[model samples]
Target: MNRSNGGAPHRSITAGTDFLHLAIEEAPGGGKSDWLASRIRLALADGRLPMGSRLPATRVLAGELGVSRGVVTEAYQRLIEDGHLAGRGRNGTIVVGAPAAAPKSPARTAPPLPRSVFAAAPGTDVFDTMRTARARIDLSPGLPDLAAFPRAAWLRTERHVLDHLAASDLGYGDPRGTPALRRAIANWIARNRGIRADPDEVLIVAGTAQTLTLLGRVLRDDGITAVAVEDPGSLGARQHLHNCRLATPPVAVDSEGIRVDELRATGEAAVLLTPAHQFPTGVVLRGSRRSELTRWAREGGGLIIEDDYDAEHRYDRTPVPALRSVLTENVAYAGSVSKLLAPALRIGWVLAPPRYRDALVDAKRFTDLGNAALPQLVLAHFMESGAMERQLRHLRRHHRHRRDAMIKAIGTHLPSAIVHGAAAGLHLTITFDAEFADTELAAMALARDVKVHPLSWHSQRAHRPGLVLGYAASTPSDIGEGVETLGEVLRRGGAGPGFVR
Candidate 1:
């Protein structure tokens, strides 16, 4: 049997297992570490060890290779200091970059979530990638105070639910939702949103994304061809509607809310509105406009799909009642705990008009049978036990503090920018008097590890350039620093229609 100088089987030592199958030969004049590092670098360059691949622990790899752990550690440290790898706490060492002079990726495309899938050009798909991109500070709008999620309350309620649950409860549930959650949500809307409905009338769907898809199907089956949306509306929502094959004609939004007259001119039978707090602009539907919208819906047999996003996250204003509360005949009201609690819980309810109620339920029943039963029951417990109310109170105080910080930062750093939608919701939009492409501003900010949404991304028509900055998810320090960095990038004259590719 052949044995190495270390008195081990040569086959097991040289061809033995190691991360990336890197083997060490009998130590040459340069030593085992040098041999190991060379093989690793070669593997990285030749694609045997791909990016994001995690290296084995030093002790484990050393044992397998019949070498001292110091050899493995030395090899890893050399690669790390060279910027080819990084040691993430609790995640072990991962390959972060390839060896220098290795082939680079093809020129990167624009950031994600633009209008079309047209090109490597900025569109919805690319915009989505941007959302997932790592950043040191996140100021993307539509996020709540996620750090304040009631983990203890949720656990207590979930434990109680599991203790009392029947084995059958673990099986497939009602497609509409669990009875307990529907009843709890009904009570929630009655008290908070001012909408009264039987638990049966409340159809629990996924988040608003699925809500739009379901409504699109139901409306099309009802011979409705078009749905009017606010011009500076939600790009994500628009993409959803378009995916469902519905025509989304644009209606202008003003200081008060969506222009009701322009909506009527669109001749669409349905309209999606974020009446409580308009997206991007943060404008609430004023009383006069609310009446006009209701009148338009009632007269033309049009449907009002009220997306009550960020409705409960109010500051510097009284509550705005849900449109479905006043005009239940035409408004299909939807509300989710996404902003109030956390979006990971894809639980929301829809109180649709009587005409579409049964059909919508049928569509839901065919979709996924229903959301999981355990989470729904746990949510019901949270609602009935008043934990959600306590959470809301705590979030209000914390978010208010962060919002103040964001406003101050904007005043200090982006003084020339006009802020919009600051009174309510997690985000505020700022438009500039100086000419520059908002997307380029957003891209530069992102390069500095600050995330934001360009105003043009949300608008359907030509509009002034602006940036939508979210404040609730970040600490006050992060928010201020992020905005300051944005100002620095703007001062560097990097604002334009093109991005840093």
Candidate 2:
């Protein structure tokens, strides 16, 4: 085993070193040490002898190389003197540093989304692009006070859950949701939104976006080809419906909420609405409008997909009950923690009409098996412990401060801007009675390191130029600065009459 070569004539010995099979050779001259040092240098340059790699013992290498210990020791000393290796006494000789590397070309990276993306109605990548855009302050709507996530309470609940969880609980959960979360949601909505639902009736989904998708599929299969949507409604929601191959017909929404007569005129048997607090506009469905809608639904055998988003964040308005509270048979209600906690937790609940509950559950079963079960348990625990209620209270006070700051700033800065949906929700939409392009203003704001959404992106018909700004995610100072900047931009580029209402 010790004899490496055939030993027929003679061969220069090569070391069986542990340094990735490094070998040693003595040439015609006394050059073994030089070859050893050169190899070590090359390995260091190539990162094989990275910093902290311990070299093999000198005695072992010398024996393997059939060279004197002095040769190995001399080579190690040369590396140490050159500052590439260091001796650690009994530990071993270790690589200390490496040779300077040559400069390399910069790596390729994707270009930023063109500002033209915001010039028209937003596409699938619009939200992603806006999120990734570099901004000093982001006032784009549809986010809550993410900085106030109850991490401490969540950890406490998580630990408690883990300690009590059975092996089966960690396995694939029912698509309808864990009994624990469904029960918690049943209790939650009943208590908060005045809607009572059985635990089995609540189908857990991956937030409102997925809820829309699943509903679209079931509704289409039910021979409902078209679902009427509120004009100037959520562009994201409209996109979700359109993606599922459903025709989204627009109905006009005035200050009080959706015009039921116009909705009746659309001839659509199904409709999607944000009645608790309308998206972007924040108008609660009027008492008369709600009654009229329920009457229409009962008469036409229609379905209402109620997006009960951000209704819990009310500051100055009387709490409007969710449509599902009264119109249980016709309304399919959806709500999520995206606005309450964070969008990162893609967890939401959908309570369908009895006729479609089973079908929706099956779609959810095949969609992703189910939302990760552990988060559902954590949320259930969080809700039962009253942490969610406390969080809402905290968010209301915090968001109200930012909202007040924004209103004051707008009044002082852009006095001609009409602020809509200020009494509730995380954001306020302001429309300017001007002819300039809101999309151009949004692009200009992004260029100045501020991010905001143009209102035209959410509208299907001609309307005054507007902007939807979120204050809940930012500090009062940021809100003020952002509104002031908007005013400045407007002043520089076709300053329209600004009125703060």
Specify the highest-lDDT model's number.
Answer: 2
Per-model lDDT: 0.80, 0.82
Model 1 worst lDDT window (10 residues): 4-13
Against the hidden reference, what TM-scores do the models get? 0.75, 0.75
lDDT (tens digit, per residue) of candidate 1 on 1-501: 343223223111232265357545655755888788778888778876667676777878888888889988998887764446666545566676665333356433444334221122334556667656666678888877655677767888988998999999898888999999999999998888888889989999888888999999998888887889998999889888888888889999999899999988888889999999999799989999998988898888889999998888888887788998899899999888888888899988888999999999999999888898888999998999999889888777778888898999999998888989878888889998776667777777776667888888788787888888999877665788899998898877744435322
Cα RMSDs of all predictions?
11.8, 17.5
**Clash totals for all candidate models:** 7, 7
Q: How accurate locally is residue 324 in candidate 2, as Cα lDDT from 0 to 100?
A: 93
Report how far off residue 41 is in candidate 2 (Å). Answer: 48
Candidate 2 lDDT score relative to the true structure: 0.82
